[model samples]
Target: MKGLVGNMGIAHLRYPTAGSSANSEAQPFYVNSPYGVVLAHNGNLVNAEKLKVHLDQDVHRHINTDSDSELLLNVFAAELEKKGKVRVNDEDIFTALEGVYKLCVGGYACVGMLAGYSLIGFRDPHGIRPLVFGTRTKADGAKDYMLSSESVVLKAQGFTEWRDILPGEAVIIPKDTMTPVFKQVTQPLSYSPDIFEYVYFARPDSVIDGISVYRSHLAMGDMLAENIAKRFGGRETLSDFIDVVIPVPDTARNAALQCAVNLDLPYREGFVKNRYIGRTFIMPNQKERKSSVRRKLNAMGLEFKGKNVLLVDDSIVRGTTSKEIVQMAREAGAKKVYFASCAPAIRYNHIYGIDLADTRALVGYGRNNQEIADVIGADDVIYQELDDLVKSVLASGNNDKITGFEVGVFTGEYITGVEAGYFKHLENLREYNARFKQNSILAGDDPKAEVDIGIYNEGDY
Candidate 1:
């Protein structure tokens, strides 16, 4: 199976940790005291500190890593062993995980049972990241259920049909049984972008919760070009200007194409990424991650030198990679380097999947445009406005779907400064409280929504 699926074929239960990038951090980390457990997990636990405290003090188990996913696996596995005893069934294990965690903190993930016969899955109360599943018919005429971070994996393996798993819902995948059962964990908080999905995490041809990531990105690319050109108004010269184009890296490829078509400028590739380092998670320290970006992207100095280069990126969370690439472009003798992000100010921390840590760690958090500009070292930095952000993605009929984050957050205009600071408290709420916030944030006409009616159909998908 490992040979068949390569990376995707490896499961939480059976895979080994040797020769892996994160060997100590590998999945299916085992425990002996808790009924000989093995675990693999996705997502972060908001209350991980508290859970750790409880686990050490009460359960007498000491945690070894900083990952909330591992901590969560330990806690839940302990709970299962304690409650299930020797004869505990899959139903009992699922029920045990309920009230103990009202919030999975800020992540969406799945856990496979190593000692038991069931695979358990859960999402953050809000559908932050995406999880897709489908049933595949084997050559033997058997239908097998599969779950993954994206449907692209299924398609790559020749499984064309798939559907998204709803947020806050837990589905039980039985090992020997043909049928799967679901138990709603809690109501979904509200939908937020997995953060990474739009920028650098997911594959290009992926869909999350019914929205096409590719289409959403094309809008971002086009909007980014408009915003950047609008900001760098001084570059009106015919020759000094390199015109609108993408650098051929992951962040700006789609948007660059759209930017070129929209601006009627000749689009060309400026930088080529070494595909070897595809996508990796954003870590806490910006200093440590900058070198990795160079290992991933090399500037086409010949193409960009003496050109007023416009660099379009998906987002600039820590701005480390963007800073390096811009410096590389400038050192290569580019006339000027302009930077623009498809995302608006990512000023707040993502409690959802992006695994982006606290706002205090973000280069853009609490800082205005000027500070962010200096940090990223761009000649100019332009971001899509929050209102334009929603318009670019959600369009018309899809306006009210994101119940967790307020539409007002996307627009960046809070009507009041007090309301503007609301996201600081978003990470601390429980599932029920988070749901309440999503339900209460809106009550008026969102005059800004311009959903694309063409994307909405009555029935056939």
Candidate 2:
């Protein structure tokens, strides 16, 4: 730890999508050639497999791991080497980054250090992810620059001036200097940012792409209340039908409070969440997720007994947690449980970064509201309308130049074009993984008996 001294340093926390969670898959991948570059990435690359092939055959670079971040580092390094310069400068970095943008497809927000020279940050052309830039001035007349995935980090660090990095743009902050040079390296393919960031991932206080996460949740609650009223008559009927409105836990608190207020229904903390337990949606597998849901939340019998209760969650990806919570409420003596999702139904895979990757895994995919409600054991399931979600999230009417947030999961319109053969590849991979999982389960159940395995590993199957 003592050896970590540097004029500038960058760090990252990654949730793996393309690769397994081995120690070798960690980020801030370094490439020490031409001019050394250390980089960390935030989003998934849709064209990573294709890029890996190009890197091997054309770029002549060897990738050690399956991580897209490693491939990205090699791509950036090759760009710098193309200049054939002993020492690299901002122009070389900019030119190299432009090449990287052209070669890569899918969401990315990256920050890196150019050896001992500069700190660099860039966002994908589509701006599918977020990147914010902040600057702080010291009494000694020196300025410091920072870039992060969200603005909350800058605010926490007491940065006085901050703004978002535009799509298709790159910024370079030279070492030991406060001044930052900015350039637009590529034309934006589309300005569609991920709406799920505001819906689920980002901190409540964060402002992503000019929308307040907390306020967005409030608007979602308002819209949800509106939808409930339209579907089930007035507050007089709702008050009798739903005795109390309860949030799933911390993330749904804002929406729950506002929903209760708008519906004229009582609001209570029905579930006491154990914060130490990680979010089940991000859990590695179904086994871990199921176990964690039980550990994470406990129902209050007093709140549920003899009363029809309404439960609210930010979104339902797999529905495992939702089903468990509904069963818990029933066990607690609740007369009936009505579940509402603040976000629209996730009917398509999120190729960007939110981890609802498999179509078959999504509970709402190819299912109606009644079918979904039955599957989750809710009396009725309610989801925010896609149009209403878009309106609520972009409530302030700011950023008129931009159209709206990416609604791929709800509308099935991929803002960035989906490749021709990608879906088939994903399905094949899913089938292989399913076989591997089945084989492992069978082996665990009967160790002494010989089992016929169709295919052994992940890819071979």
Candidate 3:
């Protein structure tokens, strides 16, 4: 990567949701049929199995990996092949993308390279995932273009004037002309971005679809503060019930700080996070997640000693990490531990890109607030109201397009409508992966094995 020099390229850090963590499944997936194209995708495809069959039977393209990104790459390549032209133009590429939109059903944002021709980026019809692009002016007055999932990256790299790619829109930047062409390939079904982006996934510094993630979290804190006050009878009595507001470090820090300020309570960092550990929520299996909690964070006895501490977290999907953290707080000499979530209880599986957990495995699935508290060993549990959470995001953004958010994890109602039988498919995939991982552990084999790679070049495009 350090030595590679290219005028146009696409890159991806694989966050496994659709397939196993095999090295072969890593992106940028390539296809060479009609015109050489490589693509890296974010988010999952609900109709991937159906598309796989279509690609195999109709398009006659052999899929080598289980990754849906690879499937997507092939889908685009197959559509381009239908053009039946040796040299394709922007219109041809966009028409192919229209074909992709007609077939693929799910949330996705993709960046692709059409060999030496152009750099392409597009988003799903519902705008369930994020995609943005920006430009920088060079010394020679030629503009350089970049695309990313987050605006923060563009801004950090001096790519000013960034804006989100609209729902169902595609942008193509030609290498020869250095000009970008934008088109709405499909009519948008809706303008809902995933609410989890503001709650957890995205960095606080990022502004997505005109909404500031940091501000939204602060608004979430204000909303949760009101709820917390109501729980203790009144704002005046908040300090009587809770001594300090301690965030489950990192993601919840902004919300916790604001909540403490609103409640007029002391804000303390009760847990010290180990910067080296990866996020536990996105870990592949339950066993790894459970074991990593302690390694990721340690309780600070000074902040918890003999105090009634209130813990704030982004959301609680499975009770594993929260339960362990509660025990840690108690051991750190906290008198009583009360837990609060800035987001509402996630009872449903996140079907988009985030692999939360199985529906039945979720702590909030069939449990009330009290039951959730008991499971997590907290004296009480406070969850943000669904309406309040939605309001928090809406109030922070000026985007008229974002009328609502994809709150499937809380309401079990996805913006893309329900994917019938998708849950069972997801459950089976998780089970198989878990079993494979366990077997690998028993056999003393590495679950993630490397694969060979080769380069191909056609005589002259």
Go through the candidates in order and give the C-alpha RMSD of each one to the true structure: 13.6, 5.1, 4.2
lDDT preference between candidates 1 and 3, better one:
3
User: Which parts of model 2 are misplaced by more than 4 Å?
Assistant: 1-3, 424-461
Q: What is the C-alpha local distance difference test score of each model?
A: 0.60, 0.84, 0.89
Which residue runs does candidate 1 get wrong by more than 4 Å? Answer: 1-22, 32-37, 59-62, 81-85, 114-116, 232-242, 278-295, 348-361, 395-461
Tens digit of per-residue lDDT, candidate 3, span 312-430: 99999898999999999999999999999999998998888877778998999999999999999999999999999999999998998786889989998888765567777788677
Tens-place lDDT per residue, model 1, 1-461, is 53473212226421111111234455655676555555555544445566766777787676654445567777776677667466656677666667435523545466455444556666556666567777788789877677777788788777767877776777776665756777776766566545446555666787666666687778877776667666656336533465446553875688778876766677777777787873432532355577777787777777777778777777777667778888888887778777777777776554433445455656677888878878877777878876566666664224356553332223332211222223443333322232332454334312111222122222253
- The number of clashing residue pairs in each candidate reads 10, 0, 0
Winner on lDDT (1 vs 2): 2
> TM-score: which is higher, 1 or 3?
3
By descending lDDT, how would the candidates be arranged?
3, 2, 1
TM-score of each model, in listed order: 0.75, 0.92, 0.95
lDDT of 1 at 176: 59
- What lDDT does candidate 2 reach at residue 318? 90
The candidate maximizing lDDT is 3
lDDT of 2 at 344: 87
- Prediction 2 TM-score vs. true: 0.92
